[model samples]
Target: LAKTTQPISMDSYEGQEVNITCSHNNIATNDYITWYQQFPSQGPRFIIQGYKTKVTNEVASLFIPADRKSSTLSLPRVSLSDTAVYYCLVGVGTGANNLFFGTGTRLTVIP
Candidate 1:
């Protein structure tokens, strides 16, 4: 699995936009870049995913480079409830399987 690094903590006020970028240089070809958002005392929820280029969903947007190495997650108009940990994973065993949690970025939404 490819390793990712994100900010340990970020301070953002309510109704502000927050963008968390993840670095995964050694990502494999078969690996899909998946982003997960985890609230306090809760499991991480799937935010978005992309193999290459950009992919936008109802929750977040995933931007992947042509090299398929690193990616970025953009959250629009975040609020206090949006404060949570963001995790980036390469991929699971197969299509739609289990998730292996790793060290993720902890986002602090300041009121």
Candidate 2:
């Protein structure tokens, strides 16, 4: 397990797209870079994952450069309900390991 840094907060209007970037300079070889979204009073929902290059799924797209030092999460056409905390995580391969949720980017979707 390792630590990551992200913006404390971001504000945007409803229906606007939101992009959150996270940094993980100390990522290990066996580690996977993953993104999660969390709303108040709820658990995080896995958004995307990338070892390198880019990965896109139904929820979000993850962009990772060759260095793997940083990644971006893109949420398309977000609504007010999308306002939540976005977390970038570096995790081991163990599927059941508890994730250490750190301070993340708080996205505020305004009307």
Q: What TM-score do all the candidates reach, one by one?
A: 0.87, 0.88
Q: Compute the lDDT of residue 17 as modeled in candidate 1.
A: 81
Among all windows of ten consecutive residues in candidate 2, which has the lowest summed lDDT?
93-102
**CA RMSD, predictions in order:** 2.5, 2.1
What C-alpha lDDT values do all the predictions have?
Answer: 0.81, 0.83
Residue 105 in model 1: shift from native, Å? 0.9
Off by over 4 Å in 1: 92-100
lDDT of 1 by residue, 75-97 (tens): 98888889899998876556444
lDDT agreement of model 1 with the native: 0.81
